[model samples]
Target chain A: MAELWELSAAALRAAIGRGEVSCHEVAQAHLDRCAALDPRVRAFVTLTPGTALAQADHWDAARARGEALPPLAGIPIALKDNFCTRGIRTTCSSKILGDWQPPYDATATRLVREAGCVLLGKTNLDEFAMGSSTENSGLFTTRNPWDLDRVPGGSSGGSAAAVAACMSPLATGSDTGGSIRQPAALCGVVGMKPTYGRVSRYGLVAFASSLDQIGPFARSVEDAALLLQALAVPDPLDSTSLPVEAPDYRAALTGDVRGLRIGVPREYFAEGVHETVRTAVRRALDLFCDLGATVEETSTPHAEYGLACYYIIAPAEASSNLARYDGVRYGIRADNARDVIGMFEETRDLGFGDEVKHRIMLGTYALSAGYYDAYYDKALRVRTLVKQDFERCWERYDVLVAPTSPEVAFRIGEKAGDPLAMKLSDICTIPVNMAGNCAISLPCGFQDGLPIGLQIIGKSLDEATVLRAAHAYEQAANWQPRVPSLSP
Target chain B: MPRLTLAEVEHVALLSRLRLTETEKQKLADDLNVILQQFDRLQAVDTREVPPTAHAMTLTNVFRADTARPSLPRAELLHGAPEARDEFFVVPRVVDTE
Candidate 1:
């Protein structure tokens, strides 16, 4: 029998709701798994076994009283470190906020609690969600569960790794330029980034306000949908949160893709994609065609400009958003500084890691007095072109298909010194964020013993089609049952 | 390609209020130059009539109702402060004496 920790969130929810298992038992199973695996995986920044058990007991007690249970009651879920959890440390994996705890919960956190989900702990990430690898974490790098020497693709790396290793069945991740999808792809899990504004960003540590979005990582597409259902409520606190009613993401997973139009963007396959990844994605596309979906080559001309546009735009926004982290209001303050300027400089200099500093410098330069038009404005115009490119592509096709990342997970420290090389891993995923569309990355096949991700992207707010196609492929691909082998 | 000199990096760091070590400043200069050079590709695409997209959503001016609601208590809000003094954040003096 599969261990309780390895069960899908949907399965656990059903078991808990049917009274087949107590919530405390489920929480204990996962806590024991974490205690056994976390030393090697290092997926969590902090573990909340005590709180998890207590919450689970509360659910069990409520069940004894014949109270109605929420959809996700008693499911142990992990939050990416960037999401603020009241009275729990929300570090964004940065040294600056390392010891700081939030005074209130993020909208997503509050929603999960309201649904009676047990909080496992906060997972690790790139400091301030900045890098492609969790190596940029001010704490420590989370190893890929498939291969500890290699990195779990990053920013959301720890969350993906946690789910992949069965440390948690469902976890929340924020994607700004493929943070969630790439890591999910690399770790052999299901990760979906809902349309920008589909989920509220209230209380999420802002890396780039316009681009950042919270989503879920799970072992299966249906489990991902289950978590998304709990998190998809509109929030009044976030101005960008869409007021549109969320569809039944779980109900939409019919596992049928017949007559679905899949567009294969020529730009996604042009160069840099590894041969193994290309083969796996191409095979997956062929399977879609075999399943009665028509696949056609489509053009997205400005797709090549996505990374450049994102780097410019995200950092420009980050430069403004991160200005609040000065020594005054919250977070670590440099004690030796004599004046305000010195304090701000010293505090940030000590608090932020290298990648954060690099982006801040780039953003500062891009948004500076003289270069604003030449850099930031130009990037925004290119952003419009990129969006238009997708809009035109969507006119002909229902959804686009592409490789989630160009290659399998690289060894840790391989691209650590090269920023451009690390940025290249996000090539396929950034354009989706740029267009404010929904996309999902699922394990299509294994390349050289490592998993490859196939990305299915949908039009703005059209997560149903994306999820449907992904579910169909996932059901046919039969890759969901595979788990990483971690030897103690 | 525009070269980001060490001096310019220092200037940007100052603008960003980040105190970088000499090594980080040099590394950042090279990294920024490489990234800026890559961004130079945007200049080739003629966006003559294309308006800039500042955000992904089309909704503009999202205003909430003007009704008073309870907010975080003063103590709660101040709890995360690095240093607090009697319900207020403590900061270094901004004014300088000649």
Candidate 2:
């Protein structure tokens, strides 16, 4: 029998709902697993065993009293440290705000609490959610469960690693540019970034406000859908929140994708993709065809510009958003500063990592007075063309299929020295973010013992089709049940 | 496009309110130049007639009734401040005592 910690969120919720296991039992099993494996995985920045136990006990008591419960009631979930948790340290893996605790919960945090999900703890990420690898985390790097020497894909690295290692059944992650999907693909799990406004960003620490979105990481597509169902609600606090009603995402997973249109973009499979990853993704496309889906070659011509466009736009916005982190209102203050200018310089110098500084500098240079029209403006225009390219593609196909990353999980420190090489890893995933459409990355196959991700992208607000197609493929593939071997 | 010089990188750091060591500034100049060279590809596309999209979705002025909501309590808001003095955040002096 699989341990409760290893069970999927759907299975755990079903067992808890049926009284086969109490919520407390499920929570304790995961807590115990984390106690044992987290040191190896380093998935969490902070563990809240005490709070998790208490919440689980509350759910158990409610069940004993025969009170109605939410579908996710009693399920344990982790949140990336960027989301603000009331009274809990919400570090973005940056020392600047290492000890800063929020006074109120983010909208997503509050919604999860209302859904009766037990909060396991906060997980690690690239500092300020900036890097493609967790090595940028100021606190500590999270290792891949498949191989400790390899990275687990990042900004959402800790969440993906934790889900892959079975430390939590589900976790929340935010994607600015493939943060959720690339890591999910690398860690061999399910990650989805909803349409830009599908989830509210009321209290998510802004990385690049226009591109950033909160999503879910789970072992199975159904669990990913369930978490999205809880998180996809409108919030008055966030102006970008969509007013549309949240759909029954779980119900959309009918596991029958007959005649579904799948577009394999030539641009995504072009140069730089490893042969093993390309083969795995191509094999997955064949499986989709066998399942009655039509696979066709499509072109999103402007996608090649996605990386350049994102690097410009994201950092440009980041430079502005991060300007709030001066030494005044909250967070760390640099001592021994003679003036405010000196204080701001010293504080940021000590607080931000190299990647963050690089981005801020690039943004400052791009948005500078004379260069704004040349760089930032050009990137924005290219973004329009990119969105239009996707629009044109979607006119012929229901969803686009692509590799989540150019390659599988690479060895730690392999690309650490070259920032450009690290940025190139996001080429396959950034276009989806640039277009502001929904995309999901699921384990399609493995290459040399490392998992490869297959990304399915849908039109704006068309996540139903995206989840439906992913679930259909997932049910047929049966890849979600595979877990990494942690034993030496 | 001109390659970024070390002095240009230092100027950008000054604009960004960040302090970088001399070594980091040189390294940043090299790195930024490489990245900018990659970004130069965007110049090939003709966007003269295209309007720049600042946001993904079509957005307009979003407004709510002008009613004040309860804000976080002063004590709770100041809980994370590095230095506070009687309901106020303390910071370095903005001006020198000449």
Candidate 3:
């Protein structure tokens, strides 16, 4: 049998159910792993060991009393710090929010807690989840579990690294651009972004509201599906939350994709992607073909504009949403401000990081009187064409298969100081956010000892097919997930 | 798209409710210019017929039933406030009486 921390969330739940393992044992094993491994991985921003053990004890008592348990009762899960946990310090890896314990739980956080999952606590992210690399984190940067020198990817880096290192079997992450998928790819774990509106976003620290969707990160496609099943429920609190019922995602992992129509978007293979990463994705396509799924080359021409469009759209939304964080409300305030206007200016200037200010400035400029049509409006129009590109593919395809990222994890600070270069890292995965479609990334193969991700993208609200296809490929490929070897 | 001047950079900062140092303004001007120059490609693409997408998915006004319900206790909500006094948040004076 694998080590206790190495078991999947599904397995951990079953173990607790069967009395083969106490919920306490499972919680302790994972918490111990986090304690041992987190010094190097830096995956967690806050860890609640006492609360975790208390939850485990409650579940163990319920089990001893013969009470039926929630499906995810004893599973340990990490949350991206951006998700508000009622009393937990939910920093989005930013100094702007100073030890803020939100008043209410984010809908997703509430659902996960209700599902009886033991909390492994909040993990780090790029401040406000604005950058592709965790290097933008105002808090400590989370290192890739595969190689400590490399980044784990961001703004969900800590969540990805946590799951990849087995500190926790599952984690919650939010993806505005490639936050979840890119990090999962770099860390050799399975990460998924549900379609916009598929998951409720109420109480999530707003970054790019329209593009942000909560997701799951796990070691396997099945584990990711399990976490998403618990998270993808609708919420009235969030007006944009889909009113439709969620499909049974765990049951969707049927390990078969017979006759499934897979479209290979040619633009995803542009010269911007590293050859080795593209090659690995191509090999995964062949494996899918062998599973009886048909693959055909297609085009999403406007997807090339995704990064540029995303920069405008995301920042524009960010600037507006972030304005709520004034000194008078929650978060920190600047001292020595003489007037209200001075307070707002000084508070934001003092609290926000350089990247946050940069985006805010860019966003403010785009939305300013004269430049509105030139920048924001034009980007929105470009966004429409990008969405149409996916719409066209969906007319004839069940799913789109592509590389999740242009390259594998790079050494920390490799793209630091070069904002454009860092932004370009999200090239492959950003298009899906622009299209508001569901997508999942799983390890297809390795490049130079780092994992390469093969993204299975489904149309909006079509996560069932996405999970089915990724599960089919994962099972067929049977690639063993790797954990980093920490050596002195 | 034209490069942003340092003055325009300062204007943008003020609009964003942020204060930038002189060095920061000069730096932001250069950064924004380089970044915006890349976006200049959009102007060439004729989007005359393209409608903008503010929200990606189809959405309708979501109306909730009108009812009085308990809100989060003000104490819990205001716990993180920089300054609070007697059920109200305290801020620097918004208007001048002098």
Pick out the ten consecutive residues of candidate 3 chain A with the lowest summed lDDT. Answer: A479-488
DockQ of each: 0.84, 0.83, 0.86
Q: How close is every model to the real structure, measured as TM-score? A: 0.99, 0.99, 0.99
Q: Each candidate's chain A: what TM-score?
A: 0.99, 0.99, 0.99
Q: What's the TM-score of candidate 1 when only chain A is evaluated?
A: 0.99
> What's the lDDT for all of these models?
0.92, 0.92, 0.91
Question: For residues B35-91, could you state the per-residue lDDT of candidate 3 as single tens digits?
Answer: 898799888777899999988897989999999999999999889898999899999
For residues A1-488, write the lDDT of model 1, one tens digit per residue.
Answer: 56899899988988887778899999999999999999999999999998999999999999999999888889999999999999898899988985788888999999999988899999999999998879999999999999999999889999999999999999999999999999999999999999999999999999999899999999999999988888889899999999988999877988888899999998999779998898899999999999999999989999999999999999999999999889777779999998888999999988998898888888988999888998888899999999999899888899999999999999999996777999999999999998899999999999777999999999988998999999999998797347888865
For model 3, how does the per-residue alpha-carbon lDDT over A1-488 read when each residue is reduced to its tens digit?
78999899888878888899998999999999999999999999999998899999999999999999998998999999999999889888888789888999999998998899999889999999988768888888998888899999988999999999999999999999999999999899999999999999999989999999999999988889888999989899999999989988888989889999999999999998999998999999898889999999999998888889998999999999999877887889998899999999998988889999999999999999999999999999999999999999999999999999899998998887776889988999999999899999999888778888889899999999999999989888988646666554
Question: How far out, in Å, is residue A143 in model 1?
Answer: 0.2
For candidate 1, give the lDDT: 0.92
TM-score of the candidate numbered 2? 0.99
TM-score of 1: 0.99
DockQ of 3: 0.86
Q: After superposition, how far is residue A48 of candidate 1 from its true place, in Å?
A: 0.7
